[model samples]
Target: MVAAMVKSARKPARRRLSPAEKARIEEIFHRFLSEEDDPRTELNYDSPYTLVVAVALSAQATDVSVNKATARLFEVAHTPQDMLALGEEGLIPYIASIGLYRTKAKNVIAAAKIIMEQHGGEVPLDRAALQALPGVGRKTASVVLNELRIEPAIAVDTHVFRVSHRLKLAFGKTPDQVEAELMAVVPEPYLVRAHHWLILHGRYTCVARRPKCDQCLIADLCPSRGTGARVPAVPEPERHRR
Candidate 1:
């Protein structure tokens, strides 16, 4: 197929994952499991519909801010029908604090209408159908699918992107390339939760400005560990719970 040919033309520039590397990867995840067995998205949503809307609203906003806004928004417009009733103008006031709230309000209303008319008010679980809705991109769909256990996916946000590189789990330049590499190399059992672990790690420990290498449990294995890294400490799990 031409698609296969095109795929092959763009070779995986990163080095192959050898057996030793595979074991190393597993060990890294094992440590993560010891720390936090289950990790969920911080965004508060009761159903698939709310999850989609919440994720779309989360763009250029923190989970805390999204949650703060959605607490009131969801009370009135949690479903496609409810959202349609509220309309774009009605939606803006709820999310005014969030960045790009006006544009997001439009997208949310448009997506809700599409869901109501085309899909009979049910949020599409599949990728293509979800992406067809306004403001619902690949990352949003991936998060929805993975969180619901519909698929094993890694939605590489800024945190995931940085942590992947710092840990040397992936070396790809772009998010898509990094995602492909992570899907290929991350062990199957850990595949689903791997997205959350990396994101949480990057968010709390492997930070951008100056990574808290001293507190990172996987500091010893991280290739990007800064010089003079301290012994890994048992960082309180409660702080990273969100």
Candidate 2:
């Protein structure tokens, strides 16, 4: 009777989803994979060299701007040797409209030189090697790797980070933490495509400032629902793939 009284005195635990609710989350990605015919980077590139330069220039810029710049830029310099020939001055003209074009130009030429001299004009497949390139960071390397399908990696950009937290799929303070949380929870089969799906979703549907929660297919499942709900810690079982 005393034990029963103690149990009664303590507040009941907050409600959480059943296993079926978790399964529903997994199904959401499956639906995304099925819907998106070609889940890949929007940035256009003819070669890995071009992809690297494009991604590097993409910082603080839109894919559209990068594509606009690269269309002419790649035509003239599709390879590292070609890019080096253009030098920073010539590269600037092509990318002048892009944000941070001056710094991007310098890095592009520098990276091109390194690629030509170090990797023999080929973009290194290894993450460390890729990150070693001028202006390349973990996110850029992750994007390159994911696009190549050489590894399953999620590049948590602004959109991805916002969407992940908003959906209560993750509650990380940084991109690395969010990526890890996403990788842990997202099913293995969908790992490769999840990166693109989350990015596109965040870009179009779950946008910043005003998320289209009504249009969001997974809105019902979303804990935050664009209204900043007090999200509970994700359960361990929910963190691992089924």
Candidate 3:
């Protein structure tokens, strides 16, 4: 069929990145580290327990929105014991604004109960332990580990996926593959902070729909320069509101 021929033609055009391209990607990463603050997760949590809860609530939701929801939730329930005592019903109103609230509420309550019973009411630092809990995955575990200063982890969220591929830093088809590629290629010194830097960059500059290429710090290093269609500049008043 004509469609099959076109699909085959498109495949070879997605070039495999070369070694020099990989090195340039590292330079771009260093540039970000030098200019940006020591990056941290946007989710606001006072302790590991609260962090687990916040990340659980953050699925399919924005950190800004999750933080707003959890500000009061954390104030009331900072520990697993506090959360369990609050119970699923009581917790509902606090996290109601987030998506999948009922399911998240149930999982959170179950995980909190397990934390209190099995881990001395503290969030476990190990990846396996964290992943065993409800609503926690590799990405969530990586976020927690990085935030808590655990080393050699790179959590590939939406931002990291987009930015890494566009920059030819990691040509992965899935989040797992991207994480593995980044872990192998990114220097050990940059591993812990890389997630935050890429995330912040993707969120603010190399966005999925409308990349701000003119203002991007690593624009020169990016390989997908013309792939993103040009967008009209926003008026000053509209920009300020955003």
Against the true structure, whose TM-score is highest?
1
Ranking by lDDT: 1, 2, 3
After superposing candidate 2, which stretches have Cα over 4 Å from the reference?
Answer: 1-21, 226-242
Superposed by TM-score, candidate 1 places the C-alpha of residue 95 at a distance from the truth, in angstroms, of: 0.6
**Tens-digit lDDT track for model 3 on 1-242?**
32332222112213345788657867887898888758888888888888878877887788988999999998888889998999999999999998889999999999998898999988888888998998787777777877777544667777777778877667667766677777666655676678888888888998878798889888888777757843333322212100
lDDT of 2 by residue, 1-242 (tens): 32332232113223355688569768788678778845988899877777788888887788888898889988999988998898999988999999879998999889988988898888898888998989898778878877777667788787777778887677777666778777767766777777888888978987766788889887877777858444333333212110
Candidate 1, residue 55: how far the Cα is off, in Å:
0.4
Each candidate structure's TM-score, on Cα atoms with residue i matched to residue i, is 0.87, 0.84, 0.85
Better of 2 and 3 by TM-score: 3
lDDT of each: 0.80, 0.76, 0.76
Better of 2 and 3 by lDDT: 2
As for lDDT, the candidate ahead, 1 or 3, is 1
Worst 10 residues of 2 by lDDT: 233-242
